[model samples]
Target: MRNGKGQERKASPSFFTGEKWLVLTGLLGFLLAAICGVWVILYGGPVFPKGDVLKAFSFNAALGVFLLSTAAILPFTALGNKSRALFRWSYIVLALYSYAAETVQNFRGVDPRFVKGGMPFDVWVGSIFTFVALLLILFYLFVAVQYFRPKAYRLRPELIVGIRYAMLAVLLSFAAGVWISFNNGRLVGLHGSIIWLHGLGFHALQVVPFIAWLSERTALTHSARKAFIHLAGTAYLVSLVAVGWQTYLGHPVLEWSVLPVLAFVSLLISLAPGIVLLRRQSDQTVPAGKAIL
Candidate 1:
């Protein structure tokens, strides 16, 4: 495949062949759902319209179904022939079940909260979706491990690292979401900030991989690419922290404060790794008899 600039893009492994449409559909669902969420926030009044909220949940369920199905199928593309067939069917069945459960919950207007006096039928079904989603985290970890292994598929180093870190971020966000659900959708330490943390962490799956993809289209050296990934990821994490801190102090998400300054400083501190590596290279190039500058 070639990009718009006519650069030949790396072909996805055969394992993922014929799956591009599925990924695209999922992405579209996610985008539409995000737009709906923003619309609800802007136009649905302070309490929000129940209809819009329900529509958002419905669209979200569709997005989850498509996205999770894509995630579940990708691993099979790289698995050994013997294991591939078995795992493919297993993953398909699991993904379908998860998707069906989530869709049913949304259609039934089930509240996702774990209420007292035992959970309702639809809530129980919704919980199954959550459980299956969390279990899929192990599948992501497996994909990350496979990508990291020697003689594995020919993924770019930055892309592999991005996927690995994105997996971790997703895991953390999933755990946070589960915790919030159990606590009646209230955050413990950060109040409203847990939403920011969860949102930032999950979106790393898109952001980091995008950075890697764009870097690959450039004339960057491997070291430079790695440094860029580190810097971007660090800045991403710092921004998350800044927003979380601000929200924890009862500030709105868009409120400006010293947190941005702190986040900038933290991002600079994160560059210490790259800086140290550069200095080491400089020291190696210096003459034996030369005094250090």
Candidate 2:
């Protein structure tokens, strides 16, 4: 620990800080929600009508929620206080987007169902489900702020944790698929050729920013960046293949394949940016040591 004059300097962002816990919590929430969402899509059966689905999870609203959630948590975990405004606004955007989605769904002749029992397409029940998703995102946002403090910060541009999360997401998706098949006789919506590849493309897009952030933390060499970029591109291609297969099978949520692809793509993208900015302080690097604080 040395100051400018080479005197003793205490290391900043002490180990006891709560940033680590916040990140862990956020990551856990994200994973849990992702698993549940995938399960609902793959195994849970039709909870809402098609028009309602469009209304509740519109294209723009879905992107906003996904990115904002990522932005709210990932950056806070890494950069600490650097992007306070962005994080705060992400939350605001998340709420507004959810509200708008619900409203749109209602406006589209999608009446909320008042079911006495458990019908999957019950409108009221389905809308409530959206809140569950929103709640997960909101809780993660809170955890991000409370955990990742400003002081002793450094981004781990390598993004090992994120990659691990991605792997977990993949496992969860596969589990969801299997669970559905075992419980019911078949996979409901996301099983066959009825699926759409574009949804998978959107999933890939969702993860790019997160990976880009990871790249900001590491000190990547030019060659490494190029290699990583190629890897990311390849992962995207893999996602496309998976999506195509799902579509060919008429699967309902063919887009589920994108989550893992996003994870790999994110890692690759994050690693590549390090090459050009290796020498900088890497202000974005949140201390891996403190990830559980």
Candidate 3:
């Protein structure tokens, strides 16, 4: 009976084992939903009557959905450390804040420029939907991470520095993009959440490097992880340059295609370290001090 129990324990999942197919399927489902959203923006009928009103709706809708989904899914996949318990609660707070924002917006009016077509605090529904979507994503993300990855994963200081630097780069890039757009008077011209899309995309690009750094410290060991990170970083950098060049050429890729890709890629990259570490060792074998930051 003792031997049978031991055998059963061995058969059961450990940290080293990868997530089941179902969790991955959910991730893919979210990706598909994102694609559907993009399609609506590019080809579907306009939501608002006027041009600018429609533009804001399109932009806000897309961005709100992306952030909500990310905030929901990523906490579970990468950010579920005891240290990050604050963040988990913060998600809840943010959801409530979203609800409040919607309520206030209804009173404030959806469109400042056009009173006729707009309803008071009109974006309320969008906000509520975004918040709920975020909540669901986070719940699933948490479940996947908790079950699939080791709980006590320690992130290296260097990796933390890398994350900070990546964030700094994203901020600086966004500021530069905004400044250039403003000075060029280009900012005044674009419809939809083009600026937000650019900002989010640039930030997402930075996440790749940060993930690489973390992967080196945790999931991967020896020279293998380093090699993979270096290669992946090179690929990411190349892609960024290519995207920038395209945008500069006055033929930017469609936001529908670009934004969701950026968000998903960033989320996936951020999870690499934890996923790798969990994949390489059993839950009991993995040290307990390590936690996601």
* Model 3 C-alpha lDDT per residue in residues 2-118, reported as the tens digit of each score: 121232111111221232232333344345445545645685533334223233333344334434433322322344356345544554445445433432343243432223444
Which of the two, 2 or 3, has more TM-score?
A: 3
lDDT of 1 by residue, 1-293 (tens): 54334545455442244454445545555655566566557765122111234445444545555364445335423557555454445545555565455334333344433323434665566577667666655654555466556434243445555555555556666665665566565454443445666665666666665555444444445566567667766666776677556655655554456975665565466444444444345323422111121
Residue 186 error, candidate 2, Å: 17
For lDDT, the strongest prediction is 1
For model 2, residues 1-293, the per-residue Cα lDDT tens digits are 43223445334332214334333433443444444455447645233443333323343344444443444334325443645445445544444444444444443434332223434555454566355444544554454344334321233322333333332333333333333334332334445431134333434334533453444344444234334534554555555555445444555442446544554455455445333434444554533322211
Total colliding residue pairs, candidate 2? 34
TM-scores for every candidate against the unseen true structure = 0.61, 0.32, 0.37
**C-alpha lDDT (0 to 100) for residue 287 of candidate 1:** 21
Assess the local accuracy of residue 92 in candidate 2 as a C-alpha lDDT between 0 and 100.
48
lDDT scores of the candidates, listed in order? 0.52, 0.41, 0.40
TM-score of 2: 0.32
Cα lDDT over the full model 1 = 0.52
| Residue 39 miss distance in model 2 (angstroms) | 20
Residue 222, candidate 1: how far off, in angstroms? 2.2
For model 1, the superposed segments whose C-alpha errors exceed 4 Å read 1-78, 81-103, 115-120, 186-191, 241-252, 260-293
